[model samples]
Target: MKQNIYHQFITKKSSGKKSFAVLIDPDKVNAKSIAELVKLSIEAKVDYFFVGGSLVISHHLDECIQQIKAACSIPIILFPGSPSQVSKYADALLYLSLISGRNPELLIGQHVISAPFVKKSGLEIMPTGYMVIDGGAPTTVSYISNASPIPADKSEIAMCTAMAGEMLGMKLIYMDAGSGARRPITEHMIEKVAQHIDVPLIIGGGIVDPEKAYLNCKAGADIIVVGNAIEKDFSLISEISAAIHSVANVNAG
Candidate 1:
């Protein structure tokens, strides 16, 4: 029902808090997951469900979104990796730019092509600056995206990129280590970036358990997103959500 998701979310139009959003890539999720995932996500109080992948080989995206939206009340946001991944069923989109890459296509050319369609669909666009960090293994996103990730140890490089993204008007900075990551972005990197940027920071990839997700939150990541872990074991969803949500509780007086 909301027309402007960024204004609403970043401006505290909903509440004065930024929330944790869960990423659900349809390509990685199995046939049996749609119904149960929606139920589990709701039960975990996840703030959103992100649907989309770099390559959607099937035209089942809309159906997937429909099924999940029908099963849950959480906002369905599209984390599209390509033009074909866009859909109207999702409430919003993280119109992402691979800022860490030098590829013009992913950096802006794709956005130019997809802009009109996204505008026509009336889905809220949440402009994002996406940075890929080396996760200790060659992951699907890294291999398919065809871009070199910023070295995991280079917090300075990450910081400058995030600052540049903010200056360029991106509302969110998502630092990912790539799916099937052998490692996740470091807490020190998270703290460095969080300290330098004003936008909501989103961290994902290699977060296969609650403690890892919570540690990222402890380092000031506003939202911790995990997808592959859930696809591998749905029962881990409740555990992860509890661990992540408890970060706030531990700090409360």
Candidate 2:
């Protein structure tokens, strides 16, 4: 099997270069908007483009991915909410299992249903342990998954959850605060989880500014994902990317 671009990207994280990704929810943003976002992301030197949402009530996923691919050369990775969100147009899929929640479906039921189609699609399958941490708001992912978000201050629980995911052979561990969060995951929480886990750490949700992004990276996040903030202010793409890149440069130096 050919190594996917995302897999290769993760492999390089050990070199201490932090990465930045822009997340696009296909349901909320139209194809034209996605094209524009991709253009901006490319100009900002973003490392990846994440496509998906918690509840995809719309049917424009393929359209969204196609538009992004048409406008940019960056890797398009699927951050799917459910089985229905799969599309062949993406370069990779974050085959996520909600390890933090007790929901059976999110842990395995959804994967069982989506596996065949995913396998056929030939997209790089990056099995990820997806954990939702309390972000000071009720987000769609927690509602849709029918699972409770881990308490914001539970670093030990988060660490153990991530460790379990790694032991289960997950390629990545994603700690999310869900969209529209009032607070991003704390640097202490990220530090605790990253210290216990061996895989790349992806931190997302409610990161409203470059300073927050910088803190997450400094706390040991391998890839910092920004979405809602970018939606509100596209200029944040450049600022956040620069912040992450600045950290990477300093780390390398």
The model with the greatest lDDT is: 2
Off by over 4 Å in 2: none
State the displacement of the C-alpha of residue 133, model 1, in Å, after optimal TM-score superposition.
0.6
Model 1, range 19-82, lDDT digits (tens) per residue? 5667777766655678788788888888778787767777789988988877877888898879
Q: Kindly report which residue stretches of model 1 are placed more than 4 angstroms away from their true locations once superposed.
A: 1-4, 11-18
lDDT of each: 0.83, 0.90
Count of clashes, each model: 0, 0
Model 2: pairs clashing at backbone N, Cα or C within 3 Å: none
Clash count in backbone of candidate 2: 0
Highest TM-score model number: 2
Where does candidate 1 have its weakest 10-residue lDDT segment?
Answer: 11-20
Clashing pairs in 1: none
**What is the C-alpha local distance difference test score of candidate 1?**
0.83
How many collisions between residues are there in candidate 1? 0
